[model samples]
Target: MARSLRYFSPRRECPFITIDLGSIPESLFESELFGYEKGAFTDARKAKAGRMEVASGGTLFWMK
Candidate 1:
């Protein structure tokens, strides 16, 4: 399914940001989707852009 989507029109432009929901842990969902500021968490050493940010100006596909 992801393969076909990658070859399609809008998805073709941003093929690297595809997300498989099943692989992500429920606890990490927020951080992954919205990203975190520097020092936002104990393990966070620097600010990081979330999936949404990375997918900006591109496509973001959520797979079940």
Candidate 2:
């Protein structure tokens, strides 16, 4: 199921991002999805964009 989705190409000019929900830890979900601003945490040294931000004007696919 995931293989086909991974290979599916959209007829658009946006990027595609996929997330394997089963492989990700529950604790990291929030930060992974919404991201955080630089200096928002002790370990955050540089500004970073989350999945949602990266997926802007693109496609975000999730497989369980």
Candidate 3:
């Protein structure tokens, strides 16, 4: 169903991001979902776009 939605989405040029909530630890879920600036964390040497950011104007699917 997710694949089908992506296939026919109007925002086909945008991305389709999927995150497995079951695999990620609770402590890190926020950053992973919403992203963070550089130096936001001990290991965040550079800014990185999170799943939601990457899927901007597109589809964001979270699976447990």
Candidate 4:
């Protein structure tokens, strides 16, 4: 909920990029931000990309 205020704020650096905070699940913390391959851990059943890859072409702002 703390991250929501960033969306409503009008003043920001012109060249900065912002990613939304809503719809983030707590369980996704490990798999989403840091890329981990399949079998890297016990519960990882399949290979998948992380947010760093998704945000590779752009700047990603993580609020707090």
Best by lDDT: 3
lDDT of 2 at 52: 82
Candidate achieving higher lDDT, 3 or 4: 3
Question: Judged by TM-score, which candidate is best?
Answer: 3
Mind giving the per-residue lDDT tens digits that candidate 1 earns over 1-64? 7567567766576636878899999989999999999888899999888999998877788898
Error of 4 at 11 (Å): 18
Q: After superposition, how far is residue 20 of candidate 2 from its true place, in Å?
A: 0.8
The better candidate by lDDT, 1 or 3, is: 3
Candidate 1 global CA lDDT score: 0.83
lDDT of 4 at 62: 71
Q: Candidate 4: list runs displaced more than 4 Å.
A: 1-31
> For model 3, how does the per-residue alpha-carbon lDDT over 1-64 read when each residue is reduced to its tens digit?
9988778878777888889999999999999998999999899999988888889898898899
In model 2, the runs with Cα more than 4 Å from the true position are: 1-11
Q: What TM-score does structure 4 among the candidates reach? A: 0.48
How accurate locally is residue 12 in candidate 1, as Cα lDDT from 0 to 100? 70
What TM-score would every model get versus the actual structure? 0.76, 0.73, 0.88, 0.48
**TM-score leaderboard ranking:** 3, 1, 2, 4
Give residue 56's error in model 1 in angstroms: 0.8
**Model 2, span 11-59: residue lDDT tens:** 2456677888988899878888888888988898987788888888777
Query: What is residue 25's positional error in candidate 2, in angstroms?
Result: 1.2
Model 2 pairs in collision: none
